[model samples]
Target chain A: MEINHTVIDSVPILAVSGRIDATTSRDLENALNGLIEEDNNRIIVDLAGVEYISSVGLRVMLAALKKVRPKQGDLMLASLQPFVREVFEITGFTKLFLICPDQREAISKMKTG
Target chain B: MMGINREITVPARLGEIPAISDFIYEVMSACGFDAKKIMEMQLAAEEACTNISNYAYEERNGQIHITAAAEDDLHLTLEDWGTPFDPTSRIAPVTESPAEERPIGGLGIYLIKNCVDEIHYQHRDGKNILKLVKNKD
Candidate 1:
């Protein structure tokens, strides 16, 4: 998978493209780790380019969340496809993170809330 | 004589995930599954294969051996030499928590179990094998 990241008003925005499965999940983990190292506690993962996501992907996200929580930061999600949303709901992750309809909304919510 | 079981194996590299998912979809479709079933099976297979690639090896790259069979039913087995954790035995993702409180780690296994008709796991001969089956009428 290809991951493009940028800093938007102090928040690290990771725009992920490709299928996030068992094999490519580590790349994601590495990306998250980089963010953590940078002390960018507030994160927004844009999944608009992500065609698919699996449990390994979720696990990576969980690990990242755990890492950021101690620092009093949060990971948010935006623009999930229907199929990806279904998996999140099935696993109860729809409740674990702040999910927004789009990247702008996620960024706005992070700024305001 | 009975025909031999046909199989295909691919290396479990990060770049090969899409090919693996597509292969599983093709195998399920060839077994007469409808488009919806094929997509579901594909997602489940993708989840399992991705896990193998992500957690099976720490330093050295290892192969994820995938064997797909279509006869009386559809079977997709993924074998890896990584850690010996069985995803099938994992607890379901927390369901009672709200979107902001629920954890994120168990969604893949949950999706796999929910999408497939049958699923099993075994660690034997120093390999972790995840077997999934889907039947069609």
Candidate 2:
């Protein structure tokens, strides 16, 4: 997977592409952890390029969310692929996350809420 | 459709998941599963095999053998010669609990259960066999 980081309106956005599995998730974990350590709390993960996500992949984000939430920060996932969205819905992860249909809404949430 | 038990054997490593997933797609497609159903099975397969690769073999290198058989329902049987551990023994995760309150790692088994219509697990001769069955749609 390829992860590119950019700042949008003071909110860090990670655009992740490729399939996320146990092995490839290291890059994502590193990216998220780096941002968290840097005190960039509220972040948006753009998964438009990500076509598939496994449970292990989900665990990385969940762990990061848990870590950042203590600082009153949250991780918002935006632009999920259809298959990925269905997996989240089936796993009931939609309740645990702030998922937006697009990056615009996620950035807005980071600013407004 | 009656299939003649298509199967593949690969090293039990995280990197082998893509090949396994491809094999799963082929078998499931041959058994006439839809796109969404095939993805569900693929996800479950990855989750199940991941547990085996992470915990079952430990320091020893092992191989994961998967068998796809469909006479009525599609059943993908994953067999590993690593230490016998029953992934299905774990109870379903409480999705009702707040995400902060829930554990992170247990989602694998829960997702494996949710993707399939029926699941069966057994240990025989130092092999852990997990059978994920999806009904024909």
The number of the candidate with the highest TM-score is: 2
Provide the lDDT at A36 for model 2.
Answer: 92
**Chain B TM-score by candidate, in order shown:** 0.83, 0.89
Model 2, which residues run further than 4 Å from truth? B1-4, B93-95, B98-105
Error of 1 at A17 (Å): 1.2
Cα lDDT tens digits for candidate 1, A1-113:
89999888777899998878767888999999998998988899999998677766887998899898889888999999877787778777787788999999999988987
TM-score of every candidate's chain A: 0.96, 0.98
RMSD list, candidates in order = 5.0, 2.2
Which of the numbered candidates is closest to the native, going by highest DockQ?
2
What TM-score would every model get versus the actual structure? 0.71, 0.90
State candidate 2's TM-score: 0.90
Write one digit per residue (lDDT tens) for candidate 2, span B1-137.
45647889999988888999899888877777888888889999998888898778873689999999876678899999988888877646665875334443367877888889988999998899899999876
Measured against the native two-chain assembly using Cα atoms, what DockQ does each of the candidate structures obtain, in the order listed?
A: 0.36, 0.57
Name the top lDDT candidate.
2
lDDT of 1 by residue, B40-113 (tens): 78788776766676666643477877787777677788888888868876646545744334233245566788
Error of 2 at A43 (Å): 0.7
True contacts reproduced, candidate 2 = 0.53
Residue A108 alpha-carbon offset, candidate 1, angstroms: 1.0
